[model samples]
Structure formats: structure tokens, C-alpha cells
Target: MTESTTPGTASGIREFRMPDVGEGLTEAEILKWYVQPGDTVADGQVVCEVETAKAAVELPIPFDGTVHELRFPEGTTVDVGTVIITVATGAGGAPAESAAVREAAGSAGAVAAGDQAAPSAPAASDEEIEPEGRQPVLVGYGVSASSTKRRPRKPQAAPSVPGQPGAAEGGPRRPEAAAIQAEFNGHAAVVEGPTGVAGAAPAAVRPGGRPAGSAAPSVPGGRPLAKPPVRKLAKDLGIDLATVTPTGPDGIITREDVHAAASAVSVVPAPEAAALAEPVPAAAGPAREIRIPIKGVRKATAQAMVASAFTAPHVTEFITVDVTRTMKLVQELKQDPDMAGLRINPLLLVAKALLLAIRRNPEVNAAWDEANQEIVRKEYVNLGIAAATPRGLIVPNIKDAQAKTLPELASALGELVSTAREGKTSPAAMQGGTVTITNVGVFGVDTGTPILNPGESAILAFGAVKLQPWVHKGKVKPRQVTTLALSFDHRLVDGELGSKVLADIAAVLEQPKRLMTWS
Candidate 1:
């Protein structure tokens, strides 16, 4: 039968291309599929959930129709404009159910290649003929490209008039089996009927799952029972729709219900339970071949680092300084009544020092645009703080950070870190950063020349602060000393400019009052 005769064929099939669902995010990992083959969908309806570099986003279908096919399985990383799904648009928007006939229309070489790769199955003995329809699912998955071709259906044989011997088990079971198999290959097989007649039951029910009693009632509500986001919420919250009461107007499960369930279960901390119950080190190698798919933030960082390392002419300068006053300020801030409930740390002071340094050298707070053939000097700073998240290195920045006070910057930094660790930072928070500061001190590292984040002018590395011998008042004294490494795009800032910026940062850390004088 022509696809036009299929309900799914009612609407002509249109392939939906993956869009930049996240803000300027070019690609995404298919986290889950909300609709499957044979499911009806509406325009603007979310059909799939994709995880962008920063957050997970639901991809909405642009056309209304039955889903004809899924181009790729879940967890596949698809670039923008890649066709991920095809929706049927011809037969009243209903998709035609596909038949299950195995046709070898491909070249013999192609079929042989596929068969060779097929998982090994028990070989049939020479005395016994292999079962006709016993091919495993793996074999079907490896079918040749031409195996998708469908042939015209042969005419159905005349129905048995009365108690006629069937073609099965010395009875008429062949005809019935033929009818059912014909649905897939358009060719009939013989099978015994209920009364050992040639044709009693018109269709053979596949064993397993409940016997097909009647067709599922068409949902009168018209709305989809669940949407992409709702389905995701259900899965994350572990709420089974089979039990959750539908409060939606048309008996559909609304986002509210999904959210309510999610909120209810969210407090239970399933991950925490699993982590505590069985403390297995994920870093250790295990059996069954553990594979960490390259995607999300880790993938984006890799791509960006590659681009930046090759494109930017980088120049790094390092200096060691006594940040004793900065450490003392942190202690005072922690005990200050005005700064109560605020997180105080050396990073905050380092951030303040960096801000002052940026003010000293705006050249460091700019971008080199080879395309425009111009140096783009950012008037406002989207200050990125490099955070090492579980996903990977993510630098979520604060917009117009040059405008924020030390206290405000501290709070923003805290929120940024928390949001990044939770994988909730939006793409907006990760883009448009003019400069960045990576706190390698948290890991007790001394210092290293960090690579510039792609498209930015510079990145500063903050080394671990510790008591070290330093000349104070011409006397060697133990002081809180740390190293600051400034890596800048040489094309934009020469050594003189880069060194001056790094010096200004070290000077401020050496004597905190210098910030007040500079500001």
C-alpha cells in the first residue's frame, strides 16, 4: 500500500532540523525523545529534550503530524540543521504502521557484509532446517540499505468456506500465518485457524504483552497526554503517569502536575541515597567497558580550547607577590557584622584586584575580531570566573562585572559557582566574556600559563596562597605569598601592556589600600 493510504501519511513527511535551542549553542546532545514512531504531534509541540553546553533544553517540533521516524537514537550529539526526525503530513496526519517483511533487494555482497557483522547465533545442524521467521533483531538492525524497499502486496486468497484443513501441523495454519506476515512483506503465509480450518483468525497476535483485544481509544482530550518538558519532569521526578492523577482540563498531564511530582520527590535526594549506599569510585576502571561520551560542557570546552590555542597569539607573564593584606582582609570580612552570611575568600580579593587591573589596562578587556578586521574594545566587562564543574571546565561570567562592587562581585561569584556546579548556568552566563580568572589555588597548584578562552582577550591564573619568606622592612619575614600568571592575546596586548596589568594586580594584592587609590 502507498504511504498515502497510511494515517501517518495524511500529512506529508517533513524533516525537522535541530536548531540552536540554547543561546548561541550550536549543538546539543539528545537527552531523551518525548514522542516516538506513530505518535501524533502538533505545531510548536516539544518532541525531544536536548542538553546544551550549559543547560538542558526542550526542542519543539515546527510542524503538526504523526512521527514517521527517528533519525537518531537518544544520547546522540546532533549539530544545528541536522535532521533528527521526520513527521508524516499526508493521511489526516496519521503515520502508517510499518510491516515486518524481510526483503533482500540489496546486492549479495552488501547482505553478506551485514551478515558477517551480525552477532553470532547458534548454527542450525545439517539435519535440521532453520526456522523460517527466527531471525534475531540484530540481523534486522544490520539490514542493507535496499532492505528498506517495499514490494506490492499480493491478492489475498479466498477465505475458507467451512471446516477446511489448515496448512499448520497437518492442519490449515499456513494461510492465517501468511495473512499476518503479508502485513510486513505484502505476501501471505498459511496457518491453522481456530477450528483447524484454513482461515479462522484473520490476524496472528504476537506472543508476549497482552493479547490485542481492541484498538486503544482515540484520546478525546485532543491534547497530548504528555509534552517534552512534562515527560522529562516525569522521568526526573520518577512519577509514573499510570498512577499520577491528571489534573489537566482534558485529562492530559500538565506541567503543573509534573512539577508538583518533581518538587515532591526532589527533596528525597535519590542521587544522594545511591551515592551513599554504594560508594563506587566512578574514576576507577570497571568491567563491561565504561564509556564516557564526549558531549555537553566538556565537548564545548575542548572545541573552544582548540580554536583559541591555534587562533590566538598568546603571551603569558607571571609574578610572585605577598598577598598578606588580602588574606588579612578576608579574615576581617568573615568576622565583620556587615558581611554576615557572606562567603569570604582570597578569590574575592583576587577578583577585586583583577578588576582594578582591568581598569588599569582596558586593552586586556577587549577582543580581536579578525573577521571585522578591528579590535573590539568592550566598554563593559563580562567577567568570567573559571569553574571546574563535574561536567568539565565551565567559565560562567557576570555581565558588566566592571560595574559591580566588591560585595556584589563576591555574591555573583558565589552564585555563579553554585549554578555551574548544579549545571544550571545558562548559555548567556557563559558567553560574551571579555576576561577570565581561573583559581587554580583551590587545587593547591602554584601556577601555570592558562590558555585564553576562545574569543576573549586574556585569562588570569590565581596560584595557591601560603606563608613564604619575603622581604618586609628589609627583614625576611613569613608572609602570605602567591603567584599570578596572566595569559593575554599577544595580538591585542603587547608584553608591556600584559606585564603592566599583571603588576597592577600584584601591587593591589600586596597592599589592599592601593585599590582605593586606583579606584
Candidate 2:
């Protein structure tokens, strides 16, 4: 296990390295493996599913071959550029040496489990294969040579017992002999002494009256059982897991347990102590205390939000407008023959209006590049629609959204929503976004100052559309109205530019015919 060996043959072996499934993600966990040894696989066939920090992605093999070996087991987190599986292209079964190599690879993976400090083996030079006439490459991924090396195992020492001095270090004793001595002599077992009287061996009784020296029982480690996020919470609160009493299933330390421990040590004011002692009935439930591991989509979203909030100077502007005409247009589109079987909703027109606004005020559709100290203006728009899924919030955008017609945009939006709801959104679809629109209207919220998505300059929040009293043409009447809030990075977009973009969107929604003239 000390040496990194390639798990393939010399002639016709291909090692499929773990690709970076997200934007510069360094590692991913192998959730499941679809193919095993001796299975025939074709090009573009999905071989495995991996969960990165963003989303769960399925990796497709690029070439046709028989599965030779899977280097790492499922649930093992593998670094990008490391080989996870190998395929054999030869006509026959794998060579005898390849089988031995597969066994060695499995042993190495087991020895390195749960130990991130373990060194990995270097990529095998002989196992690297180049297809004839073309260099192989994965889209949005680059090939790099890397490996994991294993640390040598250390020998286990005998457990030293208290109050015993040089008792049983002589040699190994037979269990049967010890049992016979206990039965016939009606006394505890004793080991032979060194030129002296027989001495009783230090025998610690285990459960069920078995001697500890007969069979060593496995003892759990001192580290408490808790998820990564729970451990992080405990660290942040300066709470020690070993000191807290665990009430969770399997003796696992939960977030609530950590919080309770923190509250116990905190100094409370005399006035609030009586109020805090009263238990709130609303918090009572079997599932009220839930601990979710902050990983995958949720973890990435949190990190991005923090970076965007602190790094950019955010300016939020709100405007309330009458959108009665836009709702009429939605109903008209749903009745149109060409728009049949397509999703037609208020959000669709809102998105189109935002795109048109960007066209009018192109300066707002830009990102501030701090590294280059320049404003990067985008000519075409990659309109990002923020969708909340069961896993977390993900913003998947349509590529070249400015060029799409209304019907095309509607179709793309429908597909995007469906894919996100199913939790099958690819990482590429979530990248290269220039602007975003978050529809808080669906949740019946009036409006909100939404934080900008990372790498984007502006974000528009579409609020709930409600019929309210308004003055129209100097007459008081009930009209369909909605509130819109636009948040932008002040560094690249000033107050004037941001206001123009917001005003343009409000005008188009108020007067539906303006979309034709404005475009």
C-alpha cells in the first residue's frame, strides 16, 4: 500500500480520472458506482454518480471498454485528478497482473478511509494512454497528474492494566487451559511464574463474565459522533462534545445538544432568566430538532452569499407599478395556438422585461473585476433564474438569453424549472450568469432586498401581484399592482444606471405594447 500502482495493464488500459464537476471544485464524494468489473460499457454511458460541493453529477465515460476495476469504493471522497476507475479495451479479460493491482488498490483505499492526511500515490506513467491522432479531454475540465500515497501501519501494543506489575508478559496462554484451571481448581486462572509461586494473571472481567485477556473487545473512540456541521457549531460556540450529554439516536451529538450546552454556560440576566425558563410550546415536535449537514448546494450558497454581501457595496431600489396589462398578456399567450403546451406565466414576461431593460441600460449588466480593477461589460445576457430546490437554492441561467424569442425563452424557462425541481441541474447551467431574477412573488411576499448572486452585478426581486386601490387617470380604482426591488453592486452600477434599469422594467410591465417599441 505504500507504493502507488496503476490498476491497469500495459497495452490497452484507460484510467478515467475524476473530473472537476463544478467551478474549480477540488474534491467530490463517490456516491455510487454503476459499473463493476467484467461489465461492458459504451461511450457516453454513465459509470458513476458523484456529489460535489454544488450538486450531484453523473460522470459519463468517454470511450468504450470493459470495466476493469474501480479504484475507490463508494462513499470515499476523491480529489480531482485522481483516477477512480479503469477500463480495458483489449479483446480478452484483464491480464493476471491487473487483478493483483485491483486488490492492492482496494487495500490502499481502505487503509486511507476517514484519514485526509494520508498521502496518495503518484499517477502511473505507464498507465497513461493517448488515443491515436487525438488528445483526450473532458469538457470544462483539464487533465492533471496526481496520486495518493498510503502511510505504513503501526503495530498494536498490549493494554497495560493498573495495580499489576510484570504479571503476564511471559508468553501467549491457551484459553482452554485457563478454562480448565478455573473449573477444576475452583479459582481464578493464573499464569506460570518465573521461578516463583504461581501468580494470578490480571484478568479484567468483561460483560457476560468473559476475561478481557481472552478476547479483546472493540472500544469506541473518544471522539463524539456528530455530523460535520454539528462539529462546526460546537467549535463556534466553544462547546466540547465530550462534556455534553448526548440524547440523539446512537449516542450522536446533535445541534440542539450543542446549543443546550452553550446556553447552560452562558451568563443570563436575572430579569430574563424567568422568561427563558418558560418552555415555548411552539418548539415541541418529534422533528423539531433536526440537524442537516451543511454540504453540497447549501454550503456553496452560504459561502457565495457571505462573499457577495461583504465584498460588494450593495444599493437596493424599490418601485411599485401597475401590472394589470402584463397579467392580461399572460392570459392571451396561454390561449395562443403557437404557445400551446408551453408554460406562460407572469414570471416569463418579467424575465423578458428585465432582458429588455438590460438592453436599454447595458452598463448595468456588468461585473466589477477586483483583480483586474476594471468593469467587465457583457454584451449578451446569461439570465439567471433563482430556483429553490429541496437541496438548496440554485440559479441556473439560459445561455445567450438575449437572443431567444419570447416563445423560446418560455420553453427554456419551463425546462429549467422542471430540471431544478427534479434536482438534476448540471453545474455548467449554473455558471457564467450576468444578471439574476428571484421571484419572491410565488411565496406571497411583497418584496425583499435580495443579495446579489456571486459574480453578478444586479439582481431583481419580483414581488407578489395583488389587486390594490390606486389612482388611474385621476380616478381612484382597483388595479393589479406589484412591487419590484433591484439590488446592484455600487462599484460598477451607480444609482442613476440602476434606477433606469428598474424604471424600464416597470414601464414595460405597465404598458405591454412598450416591449415591441423598446426592443
Candidate 3:
């Protein structure tokens, strides 16, 4: 709050500046303030959290001092460098001798000691320090250049123990008892999972006065009831099932009820059907050539691929996998209530398989740089999905993809695809990609020796899904299968290393359960 110094010189007051709130947000609207006049703040304390267009970010105080004044009021739009709060620092308390303050204050830049007032000095001298690398100290106002920091939480008053109903305890409530009660009463049932959905199944009920187990009359002022899934579909689409006439067997609602309900709500796009509905629109320009801007992800990818291609003596490896078990798992997952509403494409399985394979052969994920004279091996997976958008090719990765569960990975893949399609992907999202998977299969291509995204040692190409004749259980039969192509920088990766990585991926696809086994 106060510090001692020369008669005219005083301790400098520091101001905390607001940070770039959003990823690319240049300005923010100050939503509200937690501190006001006369509030004591510690360093790295969050005084206010501001909301940007995308998300809310908390701004922290840079210095520990008493709040002097809030320059801008709440709801005011502020630029980055604008100082939001001020703290008065000096030796003596508020009212002090003006002579001592002048003696304490040196130039206007450094606050004078003794008096609470920073010495009144020439403003011209303050401008000289800007180029010298010494940041200007506030005359009790302005924010610093650093982002806000979080403060430690203070202890709260203790609560009474559950069993010891009357007596107060000096500690937190007995966690064990509450945990036991939670387990027994299935309180955890209501707890939402990482997917943000509650886990408990809804209670079952029968129509009319009779329970589901009872032998109820078929036509006692009754109508056939739709299944839970069907009912849910109808509710989601705002469809009134009572108004619709059922033409199902025995006049019972069928799967058609849900399909009809969904279609009535919104028509889903069928890419293949749309293609057949009209001839493909040729570009107004020449069909032989399409130019794309070399910027952002595409530019970065081109640079990396070219560097990897020329720098790392490249070697490619391929493997044809039956993936019969993987296909079977996809079918099983479609029926799974947990995996419902997810895109159960082969690429999802391939991503899981690649993650499993990475765990087994972590060396394949390494990068080689002769110029830097270094080989970088990363422990975490920033799994990049090579997406071909209308603009150009972009590989935006899901950060920490290896740490996510299969369902989480599927969800992330869906988001990445959606984000890329919407052209809302951030430039930061496309950087620092460790390993990549190109789903060439989407374009109906069998396989291609895909280029390795620069910085990564290897890339896995997932080919088109197809049913082909193959040997299964030592017998010839038709089975769902696909080919996996792996391209690697031979400079850093070798034939043995590439083979192990490819084989591990194929093994997981051969018996999707191998994922659990390897991981």
C-alpha cells in the first residue's frame, strides 16, 4: 500500500493491461468488474473477466495494491494497451508533506518516496524511457503488457459433519460418507459424462392403467404406443404423433415413425443423390486447372511437404488390410446407444487404430531436421486430419488426440470436419501438427502415396471403403476391406520402423480389439 523513499521520490505505481481476450480478438467489451474503489488486490489476481465474441477471458491485476480508480466503466469497449486500474504506492500514507513528495519524486517516470503523491515531474522526460526498453510506470494508472494471472483461493468457513448433525467441524465434510451415499443412491447416475449427457436410462412405462408386464386389453380406449427412440425423435422434431395415421403392422408405430418425423422436420443432404439430381457444375474457368491461394494452412502444408520430400530421403510403405473385424465393429457401434448420432466411418476406426499404433511405435511420430541438426520426438499426439476443402487442402489437428477416448476422438473428428467445411478453422489450429491421416477414401480413391505433412515423420493414408474377395480363416470369401498407405521420411525413419508402424495399424484394424490390447 505504501513504501518509504527519498523526500521527493516515491515508489512507482503499476497498472495492469487487458490481454488479447480471444484467439484473434483485437478488442473486448468489459462485461463487468469484481473490484471497485478501495479494494485490496494481490498480484496475479483476477479483477474482472471480459467476454469476447467467442469466449470469456479473465483479466488479472499486475500489482498488489489498493484500487485507486477504474479508468473505464463497465460495458465500455477497450483497446489492448488501455490501462484499466491504478494502484497508489509510496512510503507515507495518503496525506503527506508536499516537500517530502518532491524530494521523493525524481523524474516523472520514477515515483517519489515519502508522500503518497508521485512527484510532479516534466512529462517530456517520461517519453525518453519508451525507446530504452524500460516500460513506463503509471502515475497510479494504466495496465501492464502481460496477460492476467490467477490467484489462489482463500479458505472458506467449515461446515457441520453429516452424522454429527449438531456439532461444527473444523474441516471439510466427510467425503467418504458422501461418496458412499452417492454410489449407493446412484447419485453418480445424474452426473453428466464428458459427452455432456446424463448417464441414467429413463424409467420404463406402459400405456393405460396397466404396467408393461401385465396382460392389458388391446382395445380399451387405447392406442398403440410408440417406442422410446421413436417418441424421442418425434419430440425433437416437434411432430405430433397423435395426428399421424400409422400404417405399420397391426397399426403399431415402426422405425418409419422416426424417419418420417425427422424428414418432416428438416431434409438431410444426401451427397450422392444430389449429384445424380443434377449434372456437376463445371468451373466457369478452364476445367484443366484450378488455382488456390498459397496461404495459411495450404501454404504451410506445401512448405512442410516440400521440405519433407526433399530434405528427408523419402520412403513409402503400403499394406492391404482385410479389416473385417473393424467393419464389424463399425456395424456394432452404429447399434450402440452411446455411439448413436456419430459418423461411424472407417476413418474414425483408422484414427483409433493409428493412435494405438503410435503407442506401440512412438518412434514413427518423430521429426528430422538436418538444418537444425536435431531429431524431435514428441510425447503427445496432435493428430492432424488432412481435409480437402473448397479453398484448398488443410490439415487441422485435434490437440492431444492420443489422450482422448474413441468416442471423444470421433466427436473431435466430426468437429474438425465441420469446422473446416464452415471455413472457420483458425490458423493456430493448423500449426504444430505432429502426425497426419489423409482420408483419400472420401473421394472414392483406393489409395495414394500421400506426402508427409512437414515436421512429422510419417503419414497414414486411409483408402476408400470397398468389399473385396479375400482369404478369411483360410477360406476364400468376400469381405469388407481397404488398403492403408504410409509415407515416411526415410532419412529419419527406416524400413523396419515403417513396417512396424504400418503392421501395428493393420493389426488393430484386423481385430479392432487389438486397439485395447496395444494401448
Candidate 4:
């Protein structure tokens, strides 16, 4: 099976393989298909929506053509590099060979390893095939040529007759006849039934050949039925499927079931002891439970945070700052004609100050390359702004933020915020961040030790600004003050470097005019 464009045929048939939307993502579930067979599709038209582990991405067809066939149905999880659809480029009726190929590709039980099947092609000579068309390249993604050979399927077992001797009353016999015959003959056997018991009727027995009322032999439990995304959620939360109650249709374990089980277990005082004791009654538990599966952005964020927290040596430093001047400057910028129609807030200045600090202390903007045993210092800044969306926490960065002017930066920030709120941030917009700033101020929090984004060296947490009594120029007065906490990877940023970066940000925010001289 392979992607094909049959030669000498008027209609140029093309197979569209699933793309790796996120970096290193192996598979995605087809949430919906917009076009079906015989539907006319133009170049760059979205034909389907797929939900990967990272996010739900809309896939666009690369070339203009009429939809020849949809190889897979909606809700099917397809591996990256597997052909999902076919397009006919030329006009006229659908070819006969196309129908045959589509049938073979759509056959049940034809899936290979990783749940992917190659697209079936016409059995034509090599000379009949023409050069393939230009492959589609999605932004921030690389394309790879994948083999179309399908993996060999596992051999199916022969059906067993019930009530036969040496076989369970209702199930196939363990240590199958071949094993028992091999033991007796001292060699491998090809016999289908146990010796002298081919048609003999056995007594009433339960599974594992135990008497009807006797205890049955232990065996592995059946797995819970759930979608791939739900299964991933359970795995990330470290919840066992067997322990969860099924509430979905057809006795399937839904995402809500997994979350409810997790919540119930979380409130238990001692999990180990509770597990050893008898189960709690459903009526005795909470009246109503809302369980949400951690998936897409949320799951990725959790795994990345755990890895960053444990792998990188984090050293956080805090500083109380008088940002009265910066706050005043923000008010003035809001009215300035140059900054019109742009978001003008404390975060704008704070972000600028952080960028300036990074420029001053370049070493603080480096990443730890454990594979090469070196520190990779970045020349430009891809400043990450951590935005908390309904889906999860995402940090989409401003590309080359070091070069953007105040107005440009503000506009970018506005677009980033709006896009994040609308849940349209692309995977590329969230990658290659050098440093991150999480403004806890929006929630009116004082400050917190922020965790570093994976692959970045430092993170800055901006606290809420408040009026506090302070000595200003030998006088006691109310001053706008805030606390800033900076967490950095100690492997790349030393204590001195971290302190300098934080101090520089504080100094600029305090003076507001120092940005002119320092930067």
C-alpha cells in the first residue's frame, strides 16, 4: 500500500497523509471531516479537524481536486504519516481502479502497528507512475517520507467448540492441544484437539475448568473501553482504568469517570489504607461530581512542568520594587497618539523592562543543553507571555521581541491575548521561547515562585501593585509597590546573573526613564 497518482489516467488521484501537527506527536484523532467523496475541494481548503495531544488543529488540503474518497471515518485515531484521504485532480467520472484501492484501504482489521494502515495503490508497472506532486508543508512542521508497507497482522485463533472435553464449558482451553500433545509426544504437534477427546462431551464447568460453584482461577481483568484522548488523560493523571466506574454508553469508561475517581481518591486521607479497606458507597460520596479530563494543552503543560521542575535546578529570587513611575508612565502611554488602538498596561512596560534586563545580562537568557554538556546562549529574544486560557495554561511567545518597538510589542501582546482567549493560538506560536513572564498581578496576588517553561532558562512572576506606606525622599508617603519573583535554571544562570537581571528590571520599573539610558 502506497500513495499513488495513476499514470495515463485523466484524473490525477492523490493521497493526503496525516501531518504531525505538534512536534514529535505520533497520532491524532479525526474529530470531523468537512468533505466527502465527490465533493469539490480547492487548494488550502480545510478538509478535516484533528485533535492531537497538544491541540485541536484544522488540516488543509495541499492541492486543488475533487474528493475521491475519505479513507478513514470520523473519531478514528490515525498515526502520523498515514494517508487519511484521497483527491482526484482531473475531471470526469471516478475511475474503476480508484474504487478498488479505496475498498482495500478502508477494510476493517487492516490496521498496522501504531494503528496506521498504508493507502492501497493500483498494481501498475513502474513506467506507468509519474513524479509525485509537491508535498504540503504546514507552518513550523517538517515533512518526512514514510514507507507505505503495512505491518503483518497477528494470526487469528480457530474457533473452539463448547462442551468438548479438555475445553472449558464456555471458553477455549488453556495449554491448548498443541502444548499438551507436544509434552506427550516430546515434540511440537499440529493436532487441533486433545488426544482422544476430539468429540467427547465434558462435564459442566466454569472458566479455568473449575466446578460450577468452586472458585475460578485468577486471570487478567478486561481493559476499560475509552477513546485514545481519554486514555492519555488517565495515564497523565496516574489513574488506573480498572478502578474507575463506567458511565459512558455501552459500559465505556468516559473522561468524566476517570476524573471523578481521581477526585474521590484525592480527598482520601490515606490512599494506601483506604484501598486496603472496603469500598465507599456511591450514595455516601459527594452529591454531584463534575469530572474533566486533562487533555490537549492541559496535559502537555502538566508533563512539561513536571519535567522542567525535576530536571532543571531552579533558584528563585524575589525583590520588592517601587513601580510608581512605571505606573504613571503606563497611564501616559495609554493617551499617547503613537500607542493609540493598542493595549497599554503595566504588563507592557514590565515586559519591556524584562527584555531590557535580558539584554543587559545575556547569560540569563540561555538554555541548558544536557545532551551536549553545554549552555546554548541565545542572541535574540523570543519572549514568552504565559496566558491562562479555558483550555489550559499556554505560553505563546513574541518572536524576536528584542527588536520590536514599544507600539509593536503592545500590538503583538494584544493579538496574543485575544488569540489565546479565542483558543486559536497555533502550535508554532508557542514554541522556541527563551524566557517567560507570568503576570500573577491580574488575579491580585502578591507574588509566587514561578516554574520555568521547558527548554527555557528563566521565568519572571509579576505581582499585584498596591499602595504601601514607604519613605520617599525623606518623607513618609503612600507609594505604588510590587514584588517580583524570578526563577532561573541554576545550571545556566548563576546566583549573580539571576540577581542582576531581577535588579535591572526593578531599577527600570522604579525610574521608568532608565529604559532610555540602560536600553
Better of 2 and 3 by TM-score: 2
Give the runs in model 1 whose Cα sits over 4 Å from its true position: 1-17, 23-26, 32-49, 53-55, 58-73, 79-292
Model 3 Cα lDDT, one tens digit per residue, 1-519: 112222322544445565664455555556678987567788778888664433345677766776655655554456665566655554332322221122112222221111112134232232212223233233223224423321211112334456764325444323333233223321211122223222233111222322222211122223334433345445644554443334332223444553454343322235644222222232354334222223333454566668767766767788898987888888999899999887777789899888888888888788776688888888999999988775567788999998999789889999999987865566567768888999888889989998877678788999987899999989999998898999888877889988998998898898887776666
> RMSD to the native, candidate 2?
12.9
lDDT of 4: 0.69
**lDDT values for all models:** 0.65, 0.70, 0.59, 0.69
User: Which residue runs of candidate 4 sit more than 4 Å off their true CA positions?
Assistant: 1-14, 36-38, 53-56, 65-77, 87-292
Reference-based TM-score of each model: 0.58, 0.65, 0.45, 0.63
Candidate 4 per-residue lDDT, tens place, 1-519, comes to 224554555677787888888888888777788987878889889999887766678999988888876656565567888777778888773622222133222221122211231123322312212125322221112233333432221112334457565333333344344333222321211222343332222222222332212111111222334444456657756676655665443234555676787776533345454242234444456635345555567778899999999999999999999999999999999899988999999999999999999889888888888888988999999999999887778999999999999999999999999998877788889989999999999999999999999999999999999999988999999999999999999989889999999999999999989889986
State the weakest 10-residue window (summed lDDT) of model 4: 211-220
Model 2 / residue 101 / CA error / Å: 18
Task: Give the per-residue lDDT digits (tens) of candidate 2, residues 1-519.
Answer: 011224444547677888888868988877888987888999899999988877788999888878876766565567888777777777764622222233333223332331222124223222322223222222223233334332221111222345555424533333345434332322223333343233333342222333333122111223444445456667756665655554443234556677777665533346754343222233222332334346677888999999999999999999999999999999999999999999999999999999999999889888888898998999989999999998789999999999999999999999999999987899989999999999999999999999999889999999999999999999999999999999999999999999999999999999989999988
Candidate 1 TM-score, C-alpha based: 0.58
Error of 4 at 6 (Å): 9.0
Tens digits of per-residue lDDT for model 1, 1-519 = 001222222356676777776656677787789988889889889888888876666778876778976765565566776667777765755442221111111122222332343234233222212223222222212212233443332222334445564423344333334434433432222233455543433232222211112211112221123434445546645564433334442233555665454443322244564222222232333333323446787788888899999999989999999989889988998988877777689988888888889988887788887988999888888888998877688888989888998778878888898888876677777878889999999999999989999889989999999889999999999999999999999999999999899999999999999979999
